[model samples]
Target: MGTGAVYLTLSNLKNHPDFLTKVEIVFFCLNIILFVTNSTILLLQLVLFRQQFVRLVLDPVKGVFVPLIVLSFATIIIGIINYLVVPGHLTFEFVYVAFWIYIAFALMVCIPMLMIWFNSSHDIKTFTPAWAFLVFPLMLVGIVAINVLRVFPLLDPRAINVLLVGYIFQGLGFFVTFFYLTLYILRVMTTGFLEGHQANGAFVACGPPGFTALALIKLGEASRVILPQFGLVSETAGEVFYATAVMGSLMLLGLALFFFVFGVIPYWFKVHKHLNEILGCWALTFPNVGFVVTFRALGDVFQSQLFWTAHAVFTYSICALFVILFSLTIFAIVRGEVLFAKEKDLWADIMPEEQKRLTDNAASFGTDTVSTLDIVHLGGRKLSVDGFSEVDLEKGERRPYANI
Candidate 1:
């Protein structure tokens, strides 16, 4: 999804004379294909593995990511608006319908998931920046609304309605994200930085504010044009909205910069230590895309060479990071290190006898050979059949399995 956002934004850069439109289109198309393929796999998993699906949604550590499924669709929708609707290659009615449909989907996913979180017990020490994902789908609604507004005339009723809803969505998403960020700060202050690769999640904290900054500035530009036509308020009210949006966006951008720096600082000390592959490493790419794209928007807003230069530099850096991460991801896939379910992931599906048999087999092979599939519990304590490590879920001390 982050790669798609990067390509989508690059394809929309009308001001950059030297950018290769053909290359951007090619990458965007490839991203769409990948998105569709992954979506199909997830759907298939949900259908064929109902128990795993339930576990994935209810597990405290993993449940926070369920909304990212909605968010991925939101990214695709925004891309359609930018590449298809705005270009007139696709009709406005199609995307407009998609916009409302997406809103319903996002609401259904985010609201229920949030309720589950609220009702469930979680240790604060287990919290990570991934909590920001809870509201990410809602925030992207603001972004989609602004993109959809571009295809309509400023005087059009449709444009006015979109602008209004955009602000409401922005409020819900941004403020809720702020609350999550506050908790994350408290968590960090109490427990210190996340250890090892888990620290990469700090980048996730940058995303909400960075994209909100982009959405606010673009929506503000739309308000400056669209609001005065409605005669619902004084002409100066539109200016006020625009000014407020800019100021709010500036503040949010500063917040995003703090997170970006906070996320990078840990890597400075532990870059070599956490080089092992995990899907979470991809966090390095998409969150920073939000920061880079926000910089691009600021460049356009201020028409400043410095902001534009910063945008260019960051864009290239992120693209380079994307390439490196993509290669590592492919390698991990081939090595069966990611995108494959572990024994623990499917534990709920296994019969008691089958689980015991597997556990016995694992024990017979010795601790050195135990993998994630060899989970066993004695009393209330979770242990690997390998005997090398133990986890107390009540205390939230999760450790990786001894072997892949």
Candidate 2:
């Protein structure tokens, strides 16, 4: 559909000379910018999270960490493909680079699965073992089928169908596995928050979710771009990107506004609440990066005049929620000690008799003592002993006693 749309636009441009050139220039420039920025960000993510990535390769079930690694690698692969294969002249250089990038990502994913299978004691489980097992082989099948079918007339349509089906299955599999892992993380976060275990609470409570947000943005964009070919959605990648950008940006902005209203302003009023302010600040800022990208994508897709207005309102709302939650969390953290102490005192007062008995037992047990003695004859050293008595000592004489 993307190819067809481009062709249609070209056909129409033949009649409209001035507008055509302008539109073409604008499109080209924007495409360049978008591609470069996205590619750069993908690279940065890979480099920044290299350790997390290496761990994923070694042990992919490192919970939420695995998705980010996958996201980074996948995004990079998409970028390379777009740059080398789809955009300009498909030269050998482009083919070589694109092939190598795909190979790297494939290896990153495949090596770990193979290692897991080889190392398993026949009982180990992964995030989604079945999907992992099927994806590699299916990917191979898709690649081989596409290459082989490109040679024969009858095989062309079949190859396209196979490739699309395989990609959909593989992508959907990863998506489901990622979804489950993310939900699990969120559940744990909610549990920690409810139990007032701030120590175990998420550092940002948004790390894994943020990754999902980005994925959602990408998925939405992909749906818009590709779904039309399959005749599913009216939206384009740009449109999807726009929506994701708007929604994600709003959500992130809301969190920041919330921190200020609940945490920062309150802290400013009562300077003693330092911890609350710090945590609040992090909660506000941490997720915005992902959201900003989402917004950028949205802006490209929508190209509407009121986009800024929508952006502002959405940002404010999201920020406001953060403020409320941050305040509530701060209050919870601050009052934990007081609540604990009160409960302890209540129990103590209610069980006075038991406490007294325990105290007595403890004191009596402390006062008691046990003793034992042992005697041995020395074999290595001998001493001549003079026996002395009171009268003998006074007369300066010593006496000895024999056991014989």
Candidate 3:
């Protein structure tokens, strides 16, 4: 819950109101709750698995959110440092470093899983926002952790080292995200909007670019502040990064809007009449969060009334939408309604005959079907049921053969 979306809500609510306003305090408290909740969820998963926590790292799809879980923890620590901790307090600074190490460990585990998922996982046509799972961790340091360092007035070597590492990850994330995004677009060109639950993957496009833009802007800001002390001189660094951020924000905003009109809007039109299983598309929450931050950052850069208006609109719009969706999600979870996709739910886009053939052929049947509809769903929560062999839900991905 403390995903970028949570921070986006907190960012908007906190900034728009006077500090200590009731609304700001509510969001502030909400942020704390969200952080603890996400942490609890992760800890529970680890405890449930016990010694086999190692296997979680090997999981391609579910492992994607591992980074998120870690990043969320990092956000909580830094948020405490930035907003709550006593000013000039060094005691909690070690806590910040601890979370930093935590994220580093998570990246060590999840980054490899991300690469393995892309290269080894089968099915391409159903690709969705799952691709962006790799992008967020790359931005975590530049977007969240670095500010915590700034709280202490970090030295150049330490700060530049941090910035360089984040820059490298962001660049790598961009390459992979762009590569898959090209394939995603081409798939749409050939097959058209991803069918069924997978259609939500389109909104995934909205996040990485905006995230990259914001990350780059932060990198630039850090560079201007810290690089000069290292005898690094680049008069154009700030302008270059800021201009890139403005242009990138607009580009991403256009892309997100395009996906919304063409991808999400059509789904809404039908949803009123037919209540289809809407699952992973809820991922749309965080990308809009990304856009809100993107717009606000760009607005600050250009002092553009237009960006500010967009920012304000998104700020309120996202907060309201987050309230609706987050509530619905929690209600579903509490009621034991299935939140993660079964193979069938995700692979509805797969040719029905093909899915049935796979299902029918598997005689050593289990309760849950296999859906190899596409690459792993983002966050790795959506189990494959389309083309993969039968998944024993009770067993959780104990497939003998990945039929691909």
lDDT (0 to 1) per candidate: 0.74, 0.37, 0.58
- Model 3 lDDT at residue 278: 32
- Ranking of models by TM-score: 1, 3, 2
Candidate 1 colliding pairs, count: 0
My TM-score estimates for the predictions, one after another, are 0.83, 0.30, 0.69
Q: How many residue pairs clash in each candidate?
A: 0, 15, 12
**lDDT, candidate 3, 140-230, per-residue tens:** 5555544555564556366566667767766776666777678777887777666665665567676666666667666666666665556
Indicate the TM-score of model 1: 0.83
TM-score for predicted model 2 compared with the true structure: 0.30
**Per-candidate RMSD vs. true structure?**
8.1, 20.5, 10.8
Worst 10 residues of 1 by lDDT: 367-376
Model 3 TM-score (2 dp): 0.69
What residue pairs are clashing in model 1? none
Model 3: weakest 10-residue lDDT segment is 269-278
Please report the candidate that would top lDDT against the real structure. 1
Model 1 misplacement above 4 A? 12-19, 268-277, 344-347, 351-404
Model 1 agreement with the true structure over 308-387: per-residue lDDT tens digits: 77777777677777787788778778887777786556655755565555445544444233333434334333554334
